[model samples]
Target: MAWFMGAVLLLALLTALLAPRLLRLQQERQERRADEHYRKQLQAATDHAITTAVRARLAEPVVDLHITIPMRVTVGDVIARALEDFALEVPWDHAAAMLRHRLEFRGHARWPDLITDVFDDEEDHTP
Candidate 1:
């Protein structure tokens, strides 16, 4: 009986000592997960905005001399280049703005001009 009581007391003491630390670790892990989720959501929104802009550009009739005449570049090449620029050079806010502008105006903006405008508008807006 004495040994059993001693063992129970030891187990309880160990649990009491470790419970708070375990709870703290769990809270930290949850916070990290939430932060990661937020970042992924932001990135998805940015990607969607940029892709929408590219789609709008492609859907428009090329009769308007807004797009640069590609001598050897295919449509796929242009789209790939636009995607790369959005990913590397254009900011998220600018991509979102471009998408909004394209949707609103339905105008074919030149690729170079679009990129220049994105860089020129330095407002910190959220998508």
Candidate 2:
């Protein structure tokens, strides 16, 4: 019985020593999967023009405007650039609402300020 308990104790010690490394490997695997999924989504969204992006102050979207996404650019950055370019003609509220519908944004979005500047502090408050 004492030997059995000793073996269990040894196993527990080994597990404690190796657990952090195992956890790190698992986390790295998850991150890789997430990155691959994000890349696929970006690839699929490419070659597609943002049709409804009205300028921040303009009544209509830019005429004959199209952006062919570069291979290296992230999707969020592309959207940010589009918003920045259109900031002068499009209304703030419209741009903000449009952003949510146009792409699947995750984590820290690149340029929230473009729309935030349009609304007052209370109006732009997001949880």
Candidate 3:
């Protein structure tokens, strides 16, 4: 009887030592999955925004126009980099028009200002 009780005590001690590590590993795995999901969502949003903008520009006749607009991405840095990359292939006028369309599609009249306002808030900002 005493031996049985001792074995039970040992098992309990081992379980207590191992449980936290197992829980932590599970938590880390969940977090990793969440991050991957978020990245996918961001990429999808970016692609959609760009496509919308291009379509909008194509809807109009090609003509020279000076328009300084923001990219569809919610982050200024990302928008700047995307604009730079896009400018390599697309003419400035077309690119600007597309960006404007994308911003409108995203329900923001001005993408840069809207994005800045969104991130500047101290509250829980999830878009």
Q: Per TM-score, what order, best first?
A: 1, 3, 2
TM-score against native, each model: 0.55, 0.39, 0.45
Model 1: per-residue Cα lDDT over 8-125, one tens digit each: 9999999999999999999999999976765454444444555555666667667857654322212223234445544434345544454445434544344433542333344544
Candidate 2 local lDDT, residue 89? 32
- Clashing residue pairs found in predicted model 1: none
- Misplaced by over 4 Å in model 1 are 64-66, 69-127
Which one wins on TM-score? 1
Clashing pairs in 2: 55-89, 55-90, 56-89, 56-90, 56-91, 57-88, 57-89, 57-90, 58-89
Q: Provide backbone clash counts, one per model.
A: 0, 9, 1
lDDT of 3 by residue, 1-127 (tens): 9999999999999999999999999999999997676445444444555555545545766455664343233333334444454432333333344444545666665444232322344233332
**For model 3, what is the alpha-carbon lDDT of residue 31?**
100
Q: How much lDDT does candidate 1 score? A: 0.52
C-alpha local distance difference test of each model: 0.52, 0.45, 0.51
TM-score of candidate 3 against the unseen true structure? 0.45
Q: What does candidate 2 score on TM? A: 0.39
Instruction: Write one digit per residue (lDDT tens) for candidate 2, span 1-127.
Output: 9999999999999999999999999999999997676444433332132322222224444555573222222334334544454332333344444444443342222433223222234264342
lDDT-wise, the better of 1 and 3 is: 1
Residue pairs with clashing backbones, model 3: 53-98
